[model samples]
Target: MAIVNATDQTFVTETSTGVTLVDFWAPWCGPCRMIAPVLEEVDQEMGDKVKIVKVNVDENQETASKYGVMSIPTLLVFKDGNVVDKTVGFQPKEALVQLLQQHV
Candidate 1:
């Protein structure tokens, strides 16, 4: 599935269902930019098995703060609305795939 761009208002609903990877990022963050393409590939390869959502820290501060995302590129894996796993910084495609696979 395509990566969904979520906002503070929609963050809960967007991640309320099955396995989801919530990428807390910002446009100005280099690590976030580096992970963008990797996330896209994860979406393409994982397809219906996982849902990828991105929340821009610059615009969605509430969501980021709620999750205690102290830095850019904080990736949280949620299952049925609860976080099951997490990672930070720019992760390679393989690492991301492995992270999702655990929850999938």
Candidate 2:
């Protein structure tokens, strides 16, 4: 899975252009670790159809604050640079895929 590192500078444009899923997480978060593999699986399964990006709350605080992400492992789906869907906490692969399909 290609997990692009999302930052304040790239968040708006990159996610807006096409189907993008930004996974907000921190390195020390347990749920974030649990969901990492699921995200990787999605990246491999979905291929280029959707972009999977990861934002580290510790590193990209500005981006996280902008999106009102108060929890770790927040999944935000963007379509045309606008938030279309959002999910918090660890999710199963199938559920994640379903969310991706909604925006893609």
Q: Count the backbone clashes (under 3 Å) in each candidate.
A: 0, 1
Q: Identify the runs in model 2 with alpha carbons over 4 angstroms from their true place.
A: none
Best by lDDT: 1
Candidate 1: tens digits of C-alpha lDDT, residues 1-104: 88999999999999999999999998889999999999989999997899999999989999999999998899999999999999999999999999899888
| TM-score top scorer | 1
For model 2, name the residue pairs that clash: 16-81
- How far is each candidate from the true structure, as Cα RMSD in Å? 0.6, 1.2
- Writing each residue's lDDT as its tens digit, candidate 2 over 51-79 gives 88899899889999989999888999887
Candidate 2 has a TM-score of: 0.94
lDDT measured at residue 52 in model 2 versus the true structure, 0 to 100: 88
Error of 1 at 66 (Å): 0.5
